[model samples]
Target: MAGGLGSKKVDITWSTEESGLLMAISVKTINFKDGKTRNYQKNLTNRRGDLLMEAVTLHRRFPYSVLAAFFFLDAGAENDGTPKRRSTFLNAHARLKLFTDRSDPAGREEQFERFYLILLEASPNSVSVRPFKVGDPDNEVSLSQMLDEILELVAERNPDFYEFDDGRLIKL
Candidate 1:
């Protein structure tokens, strides 16, 4: 499929007879040192490119597939209340906007069907997520919405697939 490009192992993938390859999701996690701005920026920049390039390469071959992304950032708290961290966070997201529907996304790699950016703080348990758009970072998407997108796609493509209102999958 995908124009005969050798199979690329995505983080998640699904298919249906009607849709061929229907979905692909890739997840990447990066560590950021709040105290080490330079290293954090460099690593974030490089890693973002590494991950986005994979999606880009795949989407070019299968534009109809719902390409999704999940990015997790684990950052120390050395600059919590400081401007540096804010600037860096926005910058990272801005650069990331290149491959997402949130920003200028129509040059080569089309917009992803959905994109999520997650931030994990120094606290072992503190985590946050946001759609790839601007103006918000602490917001997280509900589990229901995530499942709905997937279920709806399946229901539309496969006669043997049925999804209940509560997101249960039942094969007909």
Candidate 2:
């Protein structure tokens, strides 16, 4: 219902009377190419911008909601007829780190909560989720860990609402 800061829509969101806006998520995917690093980075930044504005508006109403981004980066490309370029995985990660550098400082004072970038690799037969998180470069954890963090964040505001244990979401 709100529009601005390029936030035509929020990718994912949740609400409850107790927590108000609760959570808002932005999802972006990058299929890495050689020299299109800047372009891909710009695309992600644009999505991030959208998430920020939406979060701000929601937070103004709820005051306890949080914004998050889940970025999916393709580490390998199938023979999808696209031109092959030397991958800039490190550069891509750095650009995302820049995204956090801009957001995290304000996150503490605002509604932003967490960032999850899942690096995916495919071999035309199998794909896997190697999850990464912002705020800590050395942090590496499973998808369950990621969900647990979300639970913790929400728990901070809705302490009596739910519990997350061993990947199970328990409602109270």
Candidate 3:
């Protein structure tokens, strides 16, 4: 995608809630003649509250460029010297159950679809998604990856939920 004619490649570097995860995304938008590049958005936090939601919006024009938007949670910056806390036992259990559920395919599918679409709506040219990987629950995960995992797990639990290939959400 890089070093190509009429290829719009964007590179961005941003952090996640936990100190361990950050994002470096490169998206290529193929236009008619030329392309553009820019950093979209990034979040840095310690996993104490809701993570920031990063999105991109494209301008309405030929060879349109994109802009990144960061949606912060009620909690502020991760390095704001705030003490870290753990989620309640029920909250943790509920999340796990939702991910592991295999019976309610419709519900899981709906939840997953909504989650990813929200991200897509926020982003300008989100042609693909990357799942987040964390060694531990306390570890920070990339916002992109976190959303990706939810999409994957939902599809795994219920094949009919969505039609995505290789992290790229497709119309199937």
> Measured by TM-score, how close is model 3 to the native structure?
0.25
Clashing residue pair totals per candidate (backbone < 3 A): 0, 0, 8
Candidate 1: residue 157 lDDT (0-100): 40
| Model 2 ranges with Cα > 4 A deviation | 1-8, 32-44, 76-111, 164-167
Off by over 4 Å in 1: 1-6, 32-39, 75-87, 102-110, 121-135, 150-172
Identify the leading candidate in terms of TM-score.
Answer: 2
Q: Model 2, 1-172: lDDT tens per residue?
A: 3432323466777876655566667777776543644333435556555555655665555555656677776744222222453233444445445444222323433335777667778788998877777545346679877777776666555657866566665778
Q: Per-residue alpha-carbon lDDT of model 1 for 68-143, expressed as tens digits?
A: 7776665432133355445455666666766664222234564565666665564567665433332244455665
**lDDT (C-alpha, whole model) for all candidates:** 0.58, 0.57, 0.27
Q: Give a tens-digit lDDT track for model 3, residues 1-172.
A: 2211322333553322322112223322211211231112121122212211111111111111112222222121111221353322212223323222223323322111112111111236544322212113233446666446544543443344335468754433
- Ranking of predictions according to TM-score: 2, 1, 3
Q: Residue 14's C-alpha lDDT in candidate 3?
A: 34
Candidate 3 residue-wise lDDT at 106: 30
